[model samples]
Target: MTSITATSAAATASTAGKVASPYNNLNETDFLKLLTTQLANQDPTNPVDNTQMLAQLAQFSTLSAQNQTNTNLTTISDQISKLTGVPIKVG
Candidate 1:
């Protein structure tokens, strides 16, 4: 029947782009994308543990905050160098 064929087609379409395995290659830059993909591909009947994912997210947030602080410090240091003409170098 057309209805049966349509149901099967819909089911296949839904799973066409999905992988049955989880991804392990994660880095800071593509981390969010990888996380989302992992979540989307996970088996709903046996979902992955959320504790590790939450920790990773928190760590990434902390890293971002630290990076911002470092940039601000560098900018302030440059301004001070210009004012004092001391050729200050910050790393």
Candidate 2:
């Protein structure tokens, strides 16, 4: 039972990690699979609250959006820095 649980957790974690990157390009199916797995494995006696699950999904969405926005901002900043003809040096 321990091994099975560990394997399941690892698989789920790996899937989540893959989708963590904004550029990974996940679809609705992948998101649904993760949600399904969470629901399926939740403890029956003390199940996860629907509100909590919704919050988690919302958080993930927000994180993904933020990552994308950050990437775009970094690109724009680099372009602006280059145009400024100033050398950005770090100590």
Candidate 3:
């Protein structure tokens, strides 16, 4: 468990390119680091709410999916443009 200050410091460092991160983006490593810190520091007397934790996990999953989808779409769009000689935008 990390103190809030430690977590904040880590995030700040990450944003400053201290971590092997991807273009100042929040990636899986950051998520897992935060999650691990949270689980380590949670009070046993009042543990993290299961529902909230689940929701957070779900959100992370969805975000990963969306990022991958967007990357794939971009690649497809590029391929299509190359094949058709016309650029097409994809989301």
Judging by lDDT against the true structure, name the best candidate: 3
Candidate 3 segments whose C-alpha is farther than 4 A from its true place: 1-24
Which residue pairs clash within candidate 1? none
Give the TM-scores of the predictions, in the order they appear: 0.62, 0.49, 0.71
Residue-level lDDT for 19 in candidate 2: 67
Candidate 3: minimum summed lDDT over ten consecutive residues — where? 17-26
Q: What is the C-alpha RMSD of each candidate to the true structure, in Å?
A: 13.7, 8.7, 8.2
User: Sorted by lDDT, highest first, which candidate order results?
Assistant: 3, 1, 2
TM-score ranking of the models: 3, 1, 2
Candidate 1 lDDT, 1-91, residue by residue in tens = 3356888999988997785644344457688887899999999998988998899899988978898999998999999999999877777
* Model number with the top TM-score: 3
Per residue, candidate 2 scores C-alpha lDDT tens digits across 24-78 of 6876577878899989999999998999889978988887798888888777777
Candidate 3 clash total? 0
Residue-wise lDDT of candidate 3 within 1-91, one digit each (tens)? 8557888998887787555746458788888898999999999999999999899999999989998999999999999999999999985
lDDT of 2: 0.79
* Residue 77, candidate 1: alpha-carbon lDDT: 91
The whole-model lDDT of each prediction reads: 0.83, 0.79, 0.89
